[model samples]
Target: MQRYKCTISYDGTLFSGYQVQPQKRTVQSEIEEALKKLHKGSPIRITASGRTDAGVHARGQVIHFDSPLHIPEDKWVNALHSLLPDDIAVKKVEKAAPDFHARFDATGKEYRYFVRLSNYKDPFTRHYQFQYGYPLDIKQMKAAADYLVGTHDFTSFCSAKTEVEDRVRTILRVGIEMSREQLMFRFVGDGFLYNMVRILVGTLLETGRGLHQPEDMKTILAGKDRSLAGKTAAAHGLYLWEVFY
Candidate 1:
């Protein structure tokens, strides 16, 4: 058997999520089903780097699967792409080391959240961005984001419902940039808890809107209380941009 790692991109619309679920369409299920067809009706399981929530898209999601069939490395990408739906694409595929686990071996990940700053929502970008009609204080949001960079216990930013006990994670950086009519926030971190990026973005938006002061970020981090943070931002605006090994 040979292990193959694939870099994938998928449009999350019209699908449940990345993971498999009973009687529901998903990214993993689609890929696995395609693999089954390639293997002459035999089931082939795949492991992903991580799960993206419903409506959350991915540009560089990674997965690893072991196959008994001996298909050439270069052909794997085209074969999988042909089998996958139009919304899903296997960008690249190569032979992988036997022990190269996608999720466990990941060193970091980057997520991006896009926002549209306008009163009149553009139908073309509606599904891709969050439309918040108002001027955001970009300077203030940057200051608030600065406090979140580095190693810290992120209990306040993480979802309270998560059972993960360790909330300590290292944030490599937080960046914000604006284009034509869109504002983009990029979060690169060693790891993130459930809804962590959305919660952090929501808090920063609150700071930018004058609902909270920038310096309040320090207090929120120190307090480590979930109730003190802002609401969770919508998942539709977020994208799993890339994963770093």
Candidate 2:
């Protein structure tokens, strides 16, 4: 059997999420169905670098699967594109080393959350961004973001339903950027627990609004209590920007 790596991009507005769930439309299920049609009765299991939640999008998600078919690397991209839906596309496909595991081999991931701070929301961009009418103090948001850039027990930032044993992870970087009426929070991390990024964004939003102090993050981290953190932001504004190997 030969292993193949596929880079995928999808607009996640309509699907349940990345994982395969019975009776639910999902990105992984859609891709697997297309692969089954191509392979003709053979079952294909695809593993992604990370599983994104419902309503969250991806610009560069990567996955790998083994297949016995002999399709050329270049043809795989077009073939899959023709078979898949318009919202989901195969960016590239190549023969992967036999031992390369998509999830296990990933070194880090980068995510971006978009917020629209304008008086009027754009209908076209509403699906991809969070809209808030208040003017955010960008400098204070940056100061709060600075406190999150290191290894720490992120219990306060994670969802209550997260099943992970360890709550500690390394955040490589966090930045706030503004362009026109849009503001974005970008984060790079070794890995994230469920709703961690969203909660962090929510807490920073509170800080930007002058409701929370920039130093509050330090206390939240030390508390390790979920109740001390902000509400989880909407999933639609979050994107899995890229996965690094």
Candidate 3:
């Protein structure tokens, strides 16, 4: 069997998420179905680097699966792209070592949350960005973000429903970049719990709005209480920037 590593980009606006769920449309299910069609009668299973929530987007998601077919690695990209939906595109495919597990081998991931701070929302960007009419203190947000960098038990930032026993994760970086109307919060971490990024963004936004102090982030991290953090931001504003091995 040959293991194929596939890099894909998807607009997650319509799908339930990345994982395959019974009776639900998902990126994994769609890709597996297309693979099954390509393989004729054989069953196919794809393993993704991580599961993205509904309405989120991905620019460099990675997955791997084993196939019995003898198709050339160079042809896999074009073949898969032709069969997949327009919203999902196969960026590249190559033969991977058998031991390369997409999830287990992943080293880090980068995510970005976009917010549009303006009086009126742009119709074109409505679906992709979160719109906030009030002005934000970008400097204050950055100050709070600095506290989030490095290793910490991010229990406060993660969703209460997360089943993971360990809440500790290393955040390599937290950066804020602003354009004329867009505010982007970029996070690079070893891994993230469910809704962790969104919650972090929300907390930062609260600080920006003067609802919370910049030093409050230190308290929140130490408290490890979900109630202390701000609300989880909308999923549409989040994007899986990339997955690194």
TM-score of every model versus the real structure = 0.97, 0.98, 0.98
How well is each residue in 1-245 modelled by candidate 3, as lDDT tens digits? 99988889999899998988899999999999999999996779999999999999998999999998898878998888888999998888989999999899999999999999988858898779998777788899999988999999999999989999999999999989999989998999999999999999999988999999899999999998999999899999999989999
Model 3 misplaced regions, further than 4 Å: none
Work out how many backbone clashes candidate 1 has: 0
Instruction: Give the alpha-carbon lDDT of every model.
Output: 0.91, 0.92, 0.92
RMSD of 2: 0.9
> Which residue runs does candidate 2 get wrong by more than 4 Å?
none
lDDT of 3: 0.92
Choose 1 or 3, whichever is better by lDDT. 3
Task: Please provide, for model 2 over 51-89, each residue's C-alpha lDDT reduced to its tens digit, 9 standing for 90 to 100.
Answer: 999999999899999989899999999888878988899
- Model 1 misplacement above 4 A: none
